[model samples]
Target: MSRRPITEYAVLSDCRSAALVSSDGSVDWLCFPHFDSPAIFGRLLGDEAGYWSIRPDGETSRTRRYAGPTMVLETTYRTRNGMVTVTDGLIMGAGNRGHDLGAGAPGALVRRIHCTEGAVRVAVIFAPRPEYGLIEPVLREVPGGLLIRGGA
Candidate 1:
């Protein structure tokens, strides 16, 4: 895929860290743990860097907007078969403080998808190269999702 204009990306944040997700449903930039940390997904700089994408199986017309005044993002895709909405955000803890300050905060990236009409096939790919493509992390399938670990 060709590089998209930077203006085409949407911001998702939790007051501690942020992610830049493109209109096509690809998270091109993400700094984890803290705002100053290195990016795990840096495809915005190079193709080999890394990326996480969840999108429809084929072409789709898309419209996106921040869910409200917050950093939560809602992107709706209309495919030939059906329509789906994907909500992305860096999880926030209670009291609305930085995620790290909350007792239950896990510093997690959340992506919620819902199918509103018809039926559509979705695909998800997560390829993380931590420390800005310096270290390729190991991914192990867990009970719920894959666990990523590497680097220091």
Candidate 2:
């Protein structure tokens, strides 16, 4: 993947937490639960930092934008073989507009990708390092994705 400027990253949030996703579909930075909370992904700082990425296996061109006025991000990737779309967002709890993530509001990050055209191979890498890359989280495969834990 080609390196992109920090300005090319898109901001996604539920008003509780924020994630910076690169144009190439890499989640380079994310602060969970709250803006000041420990980071789960911080590759934006350096290669040794953590990151989670999902992208087309081969070469691809992409376009992205927020869905309406919401924090939901939609990225579409078009490859020689086909096209795919990825949607990312942080889900807010009932009755919560997420005005304050520091208020102990609960939420979850969600990523969904779907093939829209022909066929395309997809790639996914999930690495979680907490505490600003000071901790390498243990990962276990769950029925759907993974369970990650580290540091206090």
In model 1, the runs with Cα more than 4 Å from the true position are 94-105, 141-144
Q: Write the per-residue lDDT of candidate 2 for residues 6-80, one digit (tens) a residue.
A: 788998887767998888888888888788988888887775678889999988899998999888999999999
Give me the candidate number with maximum lDDT: 1
TM-score of 1: 0.87
lDDT of 1 by residue, 122-146 (tens): 9998889888888889889977667
Sequence-dependent TM-score of model 2: 0.88
| Steric clashes per prediction | 0, 0
* Root-mean-square deviation of every model: 2.6, 2.6
Cα lDDT, model 2, residue 80: 98
Best by TM-score: 2
Count of clashing pairs, candidate 1: 0
